[model samples]
Target: MAGKSGRTIANVPEKSLKKTLFCWEGMLVVLFILINVFCASISQSYQFENVLREMPKYLTEMFLLFPMAFILVLGEIDISVGATVCLSATMTCMASNKGLPFAAVILTALLVGTICGLVNGLILTNFQELPPMIVTLGTQIVFRGIAEIALGSGGSISLTNADGFRMIAGKVGIIPYVFFIVILMAVLFSVVLAKTTFGRSVYAIGSNRLAAYYSGIHVQTIRLIIYTVMGFMAGLAALFLTSVLYGANTTTGNGFEMDAIAMAVFGGISTSGGKGRLLGGIISGFTIICLRIGLGQINMNPQLILIILGILLILAVLLPNLSARLNVKKKA
Candidate 1:
């Protein structure tokens, strides 16, 4: 009787989880509509069809940071992303502004970004009590503070002053330089998350760390890797943001982590982690940019958008679990 009771109890959570996943998947439907409306409302210059007129920087947001979404879906947060991004961008900017070649600056950005990610992974995996969100949040402040100290004040450095860097960031016919790289990233990670054993391990970790461990997954090690990947993405994001701004500031990426998290959650990646798709996240991120742009055109405050985002995230978390209960009831 005890064994039977245990099995039944375990099944309850599984049913609940499935229902929750269903709700998350359903969110994509809403995302599709929002994207269309936003595009239609915009002038033709910004429309998808006028691809040549506007450079799509938002693609960078999805490409570089989608891995972070994958990590979050597996139940982790790297709030220090804001800090890490700023640091990497600052590194890249400072290098070029000081007379280094553009290639060297780009290389330095990518390498430093990877190392930053490695650091996040190390800290999270090694220190059992250091919750990622809180630790990263603290680190975010520290990293940015360091940036302020380094720069010493508010000043912008123009990358156009460095012709090579500007050209690289500029354009190639209809494609922006960053857009091509982002496309490659999109294809690459889509495969990594969807078709690999590592992907399964991530889901296992997010869905049930205890089960994943018992099932022979190295939960601690994998968790670190996820955090590490997020760090690297943060770095990649920094590269473009700083270069585009032609300036580095301690506040270069303020609240960017919030936007990314909002995009991830709205796309069906649970705040609690586990069961998310890269394509969904991509759609969701684009959706968010559209939403914000649409709102701005209509003279809406950015803060209002954030409030709406918060409400959506809450609904996202609750609605699916509610459906699961309903599903279980019908079965019973």
Candidate 2:
């Protein structure tokens, strides 16, 4: 009757069914609504069309959130994702500037990202004793260094042919294409995590790696897949980002890894792993995006906005632990 993550399988369906309807996600919904109201009140331009216009840039980060949730659920992290995005975007811009077909340019970005991810996976799997953070941190520096070298003294590249990128960034009515893609990806990732055997395996490994392996789960394989997926998504993010920026620079994805992690953590996904859901992450992602857009409209200093987000991140991490401790004390 016990499940892979050491929870009771009998109650899983009931819990899953009500998961979005109650608890953390419900509070997030309320918070999201309040944020919109507050933002609208503070800025006259916080209208629907204006928000959507600002969204495509921010939505690029959401692409990272899905696979990041997967990695976090596996009790692992990838700080190199921002570098991966930078590298991918650099390659994409270079390819486009060289007069390559738009299709080839797109492929270059995705391929670079996948290769970076594969390298990370190979290193981590081959050197089992190496911590993921350390390994990814090393790769992060190397990847960004490569990007900087590629850009040389200029440290940036503009897309000579932006027609393709512009098309993808196009909006239908008030919403951009990236918004739809994010929603589609959100559904796909959410379903896989919530309903599939693979999802359960991730939780099992996070909950107890040795037990999951003993239970017949391919722990290393799962980790490899998740990391590679992380890279692929980073590439996808870079592609969209190119659409928005029409170029690539050494700093293209600076702090993007932190932003993705913060969004995931805020969405109720635990860094320690074995718990949380993508739905919560999705909701929290939007909440933060809306909050940021609102703050910007009111002419808040950029540094101040970052500080506010940092404070929220701290609260997000702390509140759960505090609540859990309170529950334990009450039980005693």
Candidate 3:
């Protein structure tokens, strides 16, 4: 039997039960360990204690990776996510400054993000004619514009009561609370994508949307739910980012969407969709985060790091295509 992606499904239980350590994911695991070793060797300060201390800032981005994996799986993208994070974070800070309770502040952030996502969903589902990229592009501008307006003259806002944020940012035995949340979310989202019927539908849609719709998969509804989920994750990311910075501004989440997408692509999840896994993206996210930390310790230029990442992204997409073409040539 074959799945909608045209990939064959295992027919035998034994075949399904077999595990291999030679796959791309296994290679990624090895690379991850090797990278850590390299960082340790190059920087004596790359020790565990210091890593834990610096990890929270990067973990803020991990919150977006899970849902982004799902979005990529659906053969779609949401550039507005970074802007959504800015808007949500802006509101979160504003709420805190207004003397709202901590719980209320959190809700405001999440609610604003969800509503932004809902707007995207409603427009896309209702219209059915707009490309996701274009729609999100417009929203991206709108979201950031709204945030900029809110921020006003200084274009920034700081928390009046950081006690609440400090509580969330607190560490337990050297590990930040955000790290735990990332792990929990990673596991949950990975399972949902890998083991559930809803996950199957997402793959089916990405592989061939027409087929999935004809098969009664409720394509519009699924897309809406996924986009909304994306917004919610952005909101969650904003919450953690605020805890770390104790402030939010118009530029608070600039380029975060690119970072999340790069992590997903580098981890082996194909932007073309209907392929790859979340586990790889999760591992890749950490790899990139650790690399950035190590490089920063060495005082590398930020632009140079971005250039390297851009090169890596290109190679990731290119090498796969080259390999596939070679395989076909050999078969012929």
Candidate 4:
């Protein structure tokens, strides 16, 4: 009787888990299809070839989305990512202009981003009491400020040697190189989060930090690692972004943090953490990209497009919480 009861109880939660994941992901898939259809209907230029060509620029944010999802799942936030991108791009352009080897120029961007991320991690982990938001917010300003000073009076730096960036920006038969890279990264990050011990530890920490620490998880170490990874990805974003713009400026990556958060939330990742999947985030990221491209094709005002995204983000956050509350009431 005891063995039978244990098996029945385990099956119940497993079934419930499957149902919940299916419902959310299913809804996202339906929504994704609808979005693409709508986009295609409204714009002739929304065809596959044009969409693929435009995707590389937008896909840069997906790189940030992966790490940002991890950070969000850790129940923390980092707003300094945009600034890190700006600084990294600035340094990358500067290094290239100085006639350094292409490899060294790439390293410079990644190195700067990693150092910025390390600084955020050190301050947050060591302080223990400081909120991640406030710490990252400060770093955001500091990073952008440094980039501004480096940029001098013009506030921009164009790449003198565009050959390398041009090569990277090349397409592979109507598909951008960055597209494949994004897909590869998506698979890697999804596997890590869904299949690894470290991934489970992240969930445990997000669910309850004190309990996770008591259970032997090195919570602070993991936090440090994630933050550093966030910085590294921001550097990578800068690299590809430079490939697109062929230059760097103060406003480079200005609104990236918000866009990343919006994509994650729209994909059903809880900002409160301990819930959600990277798969949802990837779908939502592409959904938003397609929507934005469609809107741009219609020659919509940029600010108006931002407003529309803001509204969608609010609905995404609110709808989930409302559904949870209603579910609780019904159970009562």
Prediction-by-prediction clash tally? 3, 0, 0, 0
Q: Which candidate number has the best lDDT? A: 2
RMSD of each: 6.5, 4.4, 4.5, 2.5
Please provide the root mean square deviation of candidate 3 (C-alpha atoms, Å): 4.5
Q: What is the alpha-carbon RMSD of candidate 2 to the true structure?
A: 4.4
TM-score of each: 0.82, 0.94, 0.93, 0.94
Cα lDDT for residue 80, model 1? 74
Q: In candidate 3, how many clashes are counted? A: 0
Please, what are the lDDT tens digits per residue for candidate 1 over residues 15-133?
Answer: 57556555545457566676667656664444553533333545446644577777786787877777777788788878877888778887887777777778777887889688888
Ranking by lDDT: 2, 4, 3, 1
lDDT of 3 by residue, 1-332 (tens): 99999998888755232254656677677777988888888898998999889999889899889988988999988899999999999999999999999999999888998888888888888988898899999999999999999988448999989999999999999989999999999999999999999999999998999999999999999999999988988999999999999999888889999999998998888888788899989988898888888877788899998998898779878877998999999999
Per-residue lDDT value at 248 in model 1: 72
Better of 1 and 4 by TM-score: 4
- Give the range where candidate 4 is weakest over 10 consecutive residues by summed lDDT: 5-14
User: Per-residue alpha-carbon lDDT of model 4 for 1-332, expressed as tens digits?
Assistant: 24755653343434575576568677888788898999999998999888888888899999899989999999999999999999999999999999999999889989999999999999999999999999999999999999999988558999888998998899889999999999999999999998999999999898999999999999999999999999999999999999999999999999999899989988888888888899999998998999999989999899999998899889988987899899999999
Query: Residue 279 in candidate 3 has what lDDT?
Result: 91
lDDT of each model, Cα atoms only? Answer: 0.72, 0.93, 0.89, 0.91
Which stretches of model 3 miss by more than 4 angstroms? 1-19
Clashing pairs in 2: none
> Would you give me the overall lDDT of model 4?
0.91
The alpha-carbon root-mean-square deviation between model 4 and the true structure, to one decimal in Å, is 2.5
